[model samples]
Target: MPMSEEAKALRRVYQREYRRTHPEQLKRQRECTRQWQRQHPEKCREYQRRYWERKAAQENK
Candidate 1:
């Protein structure tokens, strides 16, 4: 997998120099995630769901 221009630009915008040193496969995954979050609100909703689930679980603990 390769990083798209959008992801490269995002990395620069966010000052994520660490992504440069990371393996490209992980970078590609992050890039895909970023793109999906930009293009799909439902994906973000899923993220929110997982977030609340983790939070609820931690609170229960």
Candidate 2:
């Protein structure tokens, strides 16, 4: 089932508070993401290219 807007908003607030109180966890998460990107440079570049292409297409609409 899909969450209602209020439920989604509350979840977002909870996540923001959790991240605010867990700096180390956020740092580790970012480090893990960076490591994955380093191991898949070509994939990351392709993803970025596609992302910008979509963004540009949306802007032109």
Candidate 3:
């Protein structure tokens, strides 16, 4: 099921509060993300190429 706007807002507030109290967790998450990107360079390039293609198509429409 899709989240309601209020539900999404509550989630954002909760995430913001969690991050405020969890610096180490956030640091670990960022490090994991960087490691994944380094290990999946081709996948990242393909994702970026598709993202730009979709964005340009949207702008031209």
lDDT of 2 by residue, 1-61 (tens): 9999999999999999999999999999999999999999999999999999999999999
- Candidate 1: stretches off by over 4 Å: 1-22, 57-61
The residue ranges of model 3 lying beyond 4 angstroms of the native Cα positions read: none
Candidate 1 lDDT over residue span 1-61, tens digit each:
9999999899786666665566786878999988988899987899899999999999999
The lDDT values for all models are 0.86, 0.99, 0.99
User: Against the true structure, what is each candidate's TM-score?
Assistant: 0.41, 0.77, 0.80
The numbered model that scores best in TM-score is: 3
Error of 2 at 22 (Å): 1.7
The root-mean-square deviation over C-alpha atoms between each candidate and the true structure, in angstroms, is 12.1, 2.1, 1.6
lDDT of 3: 0.99
Tell me which residue pairs clash in candidate 3: none
Q: What is the lDDT of residue 61 in candidate 3?
A: 100
Q: Give the TM-score comparing model 2 with the true structure, all chains together.
A: 0.77
